[model samples]
Target: MKLVKEVIARFPADAAILDPFSGTATTTLTAAERGNSALSFDINPFLIWLGNVKCRSYSVEHLACIQDDARLAIGRVPSLIKNDNWVPPLFNIERWWSAGTLQVLAALRAGLVEVFGEPTEDRTDGLAWVAFCRLVIETSAAAFNHVSMSFSSETTHHEVEHVTYLYLAILDAVLASGSAQLQGTGEVVEVDARAIPKMGRRFSLVVTSPPYPNRISYIRELRPYMYWMKFLKEAREAGEMDWKAIGGTWGIATSRLNEWGPNSKVLPEILTDTVGRIAESGGKNAPLMATYVHKYFYDMHLHLSSLPNVLEPGAELHYIVGNSSFFGNMVDTPAILAASMQMLGYSNTVSKIIRKRNCNKALFEYDVSASWPG
Candidate 1:
């Protein structure tokens, strides 16, 4: 948040801040706090919902009502889960919930749905769900070392009061902290960064920290949340989500090649370069490496294309980027992306490398890099 504020300070007060790939709407919210009109979009539906509703202004009365609703949902949790008629047939009914705990969550979810519907009713609903989502992780049976959603049967933790109280506390804190006031009026759209052009909007500043090419697969890392939202199951049933995608870790660094074919030439070049390197690697992990490169370049292309439409001429875009060595190969994504943006009709001369953190990279001392629109 502090870094975002510092970078934002360089722009004007009424700057239309935009984050084309707003993972969790960090920049979007920051813009709102500074009284700037903020717009953001993400490929993840859950994230879109989270950012959109959380950033909207809310009333104290509305928050209080949601709090009461949450309590009521908690009260009816156990019974709601046990009622066979309400359970989704495809889910493992027997293991879906830990009897009482599942009931609580289900009831809470049902109550929210009853009041506001699942997609989120208001800012308060967003706050409640955020709190609930965090609780789900902490109280879940998933392993600590593995961020994946594999539960451990040997672990036994009671989820009744603890989880409920945790959710309430978080919701209270989010509301009390004046997040709603800070957020103002903002919208979170569920769309790929590549699809930004279709939205046809422009901004004063575009601030975002896109996923580094060598970092974790974002989509895969978010499987648990996807599963919770039942999107995984829906996609699996519809043949949209399959083993290949799962194995690829939810299309983080890999996407269907055809998706990028229509885009600018930048993606194709990056993909070709990355694929050549992976082939040179020549190992079983070759496939994973190829996917990473493909996804990275494709996303970069899509992201850059959207900015031209959404940004005013010479309006600055600050990207927090990092360079990393993957499989002992240096992928100069920062320079490449900046150059790509330049090629796409944006100037790329005015930028700086502000170090926020660092890693053991002999060539570069910092993990953070800053850029301004050319």
Candidate 2:
């Protein structure tokens, strides 16, 4: 949030900000809070809902409505749990949440759906879902300190009182921090970055962070939230969703990547050579990993190439991206993107190390900025 505020301060108070890679809506909400109208796009529907939830303005009455809905929902949780009919059929559900916990979540979700049914109810439902998602994660057996997530079977899910109290507490904490008057606001659309032009709206500033070239599958990381939100139903569905996203290599996405090839001349010799080196790394997964890296850049190229259609003349873009290492070979993704921007007729392309990550001495988060010439 601090980073977004600092960058947004560089733009005008009324600048129309655009974030095509709107994960969790950090840029969108920050822009709105700073009095700049903003639009955010993401391929993930869950993310779209989340962006809308966090960016919407809430008055005192709206806050009261949310409190009422929450209390009503909590009141219904116990009755719904007594019936035990609506537990999500997530695959191996116990692997993440215990039986007692899942029942409470199911009840709370059902209760929210029932109470937040007014057609005029705007962000209330979305906010409740966010708090519920936090509750779900906090009480689960999953631990998230490392890149790879792990679970403990011996975990003890929080009790009903704990879940209910935590859910309300999360709402209070997030609302307290984010409910500053919305000086400027805009809508969030569930769309691919490459399709931004089709939205038929032009933007004055771009503040976003594209997915890194790392092999981590965002879908794999988001499974728990996606499952509870009903955005994902099965393993195959998760794989299909990941397959459609940039830099995604989860489930069947990895296998499909093996059959993928770049259709554009977006990669320069340095990256093309890096791909070859990774493929020759002498492991069964090496070839697949190589394709994963190649596809990420190609998709990003498509995204960058499409930005001209949606950005105003001389629109400034600030992308917080990261470089990656594959088999001891540096992908130099930020520099590669800077070059690509210049090749695409953008001007003043600059790549700077914005922050150094704790992992991998060679890996650093980068700020790749450029201007689109009208």
Candidate 3:
């Protein structure tokens, strides 16, 4: 948030800000609160719903009524999961939550559907749903502090109090935060980053943190929320979305391994060298890793190439990215992105290491800053 403020300070108060990969809407919310017109896009439907809810204007009284309705509905509904009932297939529920806990969750889920109906673009149902999602994690056996989803060694149990009161409390907090007076207009859309040029609006600034080249599967991480919200119905749908995402590991098939090919001519030499070395290492997963790395940079090349069409002359761009090491080969993502931006005719390109991560010696986050020629 501080970085976004610092970068936005360089432009006029009315300057438009764009975040292509607006993960949780941090950049969009920051820009809107500062009285700047902001636009955000994400391919993930769940993320888009989250971002839209965060950006929307909500009434405290209306939200309070919704909270009351939810509480009442939860009391009336019974805890029941039939054999034909739908549940997220990401993991076994018994492993993560006690039977009693799942029963309460099922009741809450049914109550939410009965009370709130499906989420629509016009109402606060999306906010209510997000609050439920929060409750899921807070009451589950998963370690909430970890960066990734991790189940406790022992199953965690929850009482009715945990589901009812906790959800109401979380909903109240969400309402309190959403009641803030927004200074500027914020718009969020579901679209691919490469399709920005088609919007036909030149932005004055761009602030985004794209998915790192690491093997982390964001789609997998979001599976629970997506499934619960009905954004994704099956594993095949999840794999399709992951395949279109910028950085993905689990969805790439072996037959399509050769499709990623070599590095693009516009990228830095280090990227090509790193990919070549990884492919030649003869490790079990080396080829897959190499393809993933190559596909990431290649996708970025296509995305950066289109930025000029939607950026105002002299507009600034700040990309928060991280370097990664796969199979002991370093992928200097920031440097390669800087090179790609320069190749796309962006001038005054610069890459700076913002902070070093403790998890890996080779991992370092960077800010790749550049300007479109006026």
Candidate 4:
């Protein structure tokens, strides 16, 4: 975020900043903090809701009103969970959590719904809903369940008694710390990036960290949240839910087998050729690798192609991307994405590696910088 802020500072514009692939709405919210008009897009509507609500502010007085309502709403939780027919039958309630913990969290969600009454347009209602949902992950009985960290295969978490109030309490601290950031409402539209032409011609500054190969797919990674919000089911039922639409291999594989990406006209063959070599070493996971490479390249291509049309010519585009390793072979995702941007007429100005605590996503979380050509 600091790096992004720096780039935007050099450009210096209060024009409509855009984050086309806005995941958590980091870019959009940051821009808003700087007083820039912002537009954020994401296929995941749940994230849009989170980002929108996070960037908005509520007063202590207003929160008190909502808190009172929250207490009343929490009272209905027992009945809600008792009637919850959809709470994964396959989930090993015994192995994953204790009955006590499950009841507590479930009750919390029910109480939250009772208080907020299903997230209306009012700012106070919106914040309460977001707060309640955020608490779900924090209070969960499972260890490291917040966004796919290392899982202990030997010891499974099953007791609902393992609930923690710290998650909600910490959330309260975070909300209070940045009380000012949560002032206004930002619109979140669940739509395709390719179809963005219908919305507007250009944006002020574009900032995004698109998906990287071997990294968890955004759709799959955030599936739990999406399911909670009721968007994923709707998409699946509407026939718009496919592998590619959800950042899966089927969509990506289809792209690679048929020339695709920002440099599709030039780099598709190269990517295909490289991926082919990596697949040749496959024993059991060969098919999986083939599919992964295909999807990664194709998705990256789409992002590169979609952005230029949505941003003002020469508008600064800050893309924080990195490479990936599959079966010990390196796929230069940042370079590939950069090349694709150039293929679509964006200039590669800067690409730098940021040294950070490397997590499970990739070997590195380097920042690859670029600018759209005027």
Global lDDT of each model? 0.60, 0.80, 0.79, 0.58
Report the error of model 3 at residue 335, Å.
Answer: 0.9
The model with the greater TM-score, 1 or 4, is: 1
Q: Which candidate leads in lDDT?
A: 2
Off by over 4 Å in 3: 78-86, 144-148, 252-255, 262-266
- 355: Cα error in model 4, Å: 2.8
Worst 10 residues of 3 by lDDT: 77-86
| Total clashes for model 1 | 5
Give the TM-score of each candidate: 0.79, 0.93, 0.92, 0.78
- lDDT (tens digit, per residue) of candidate 1 on 1-374: 66689878887777788887677888888888778888887766667777876677777787787778777767765555444423333344334345556556665666656655555434346666666666656655655442344556643445657656777787777667543476344677765566556455667677777766653455554555656655445434322332122122343223343232333444436546756787577666665665656556666766676656666766776677766565666666566666666656666434456563345663332223323353
Worst-scoring 10-residue span by lDDT in model 1: 238-247
98-160, model 2: which lDDT tens digit per residue? 777777777777887788752122545466677778888888888885468888967676677
Model 4, 38-100: lDDT tens per residue? 777766556767766766666777666765565465455545555343442312444433455
Which residue window of length 10 is worst by lDDT in model 2?
A: 117-126
Angstrom error at residue 173, model 3: 1.8
Which residue runs of candidate 1 sit more than 4 Å off their true CA positions? 78-100, 121-124, 143-153, 178-180, 198-200, 235-275, 350-374
Alpha-carbon RMSD, each predicted model: 4.5, 2.2, 2.3, 4.7
Which candidate, 1 or 2, would have the higher lDDT against the true structure?
2
Give the clashing pairs for model 3.
Answer: none
Q: Between candidates 3 and 4, name the one with more favorable TM-score.
A: 3
